[model samples]
Target: MDAYYNCLGCMNRQVRVLTMDGQQHEGTIVKVDRNNVYLKKESNGRVQTSAFYPGYGYGNQILTLSLFTLLAIALI
Candidate 1:
């Protein structure tokens, strides 16, 4: 099965991804291409505030995972 094609159908949707290294990431799919899948990672309810700038919410983070490294991608 082509991981890229599978991920293409999941764009802009929340999903849980498991990589070949056994790491799990839950996020909203931001982009999918031939080589990678970009995810807007969900925060675990812990606000990430920078010390340099107080009271600033960094917001959700984006992660880039290789398409070949993805072991599983499930809709949440």
Candidate 2:
């Protein structure tokens, strides 16, 4: 999906910035929009939320079609 909708909410407050190479940055999903996902890194074993952005930062993180299906199902 070029844009993410309700992904942060589907994430159930947990969000991770994923890299194409499978590397991931774990954080709490604070907000979501068409552009970027905002995540606040886990600090002191507690998570925080941040503002949203336009796109992924690490690299071109493309979500496979199957992943999209999974997300859709999850959202429902």
Candidate 3:
């Protein structure tokens, strides 16, 4: 979980997340754990309820990114 901590230090900051699959996501790191990294995207907010909003689209959203798939994370 050392690498997870590395990204853990980035909590609340905008970051670019790269995964092993070549997929990337840019958002603010909200929370992190041993298994996953949670994020609140710039386009999303608390006003938009997660119930109505889809998984990764605009509105209140929390992206649960699996740490196992993470390749690199960079503060933006």
Residues 1-76, model 1: lDDT tens digits:
4899889999999999999999898877777778888777746764222122223235544577889999999999
After TM-score superposition, the amount by which residue 32's alpha carbon in candidate 3 deviates from its true location, in angstroms, is 0.5
- Single out the weakest 10-residue window by summed lDDT for candidate 2: 67-76
Give candidate 1's whole-model lDDT: 0.76
For each candidate, what TM-score against the reference?
Answer: 0.76, 0.42, 0.74
Tens digits of per-residue lDDT, candidate 3, 1-76, equal 8668977899889999898999888887777889888877655533321223244555556777889899999998
> Poorest 10 consecutive residues of model 3 by lDDT?
45-54
**Runs in model 1 with CA error above 4 Å?**
46-60
Question: Which candidate, 2 or 3, would have the higher TM-score against the true structure?
Answer: 3
The clash numbers for all candidates, in the given order, read 0, 2, 0
Model 1 weakest 10-residue run by lDDT: 47-56
Q: For each candidate in turn, give its C-alpha RMSD to the true structure in angstroms.
A: 6.0, 9.0, 5.4
Cα error, candidate 3, residue 58 (Å):
13
Q: Using lDDT, rank the candidates from best to worst.
A: 1, 3, 2
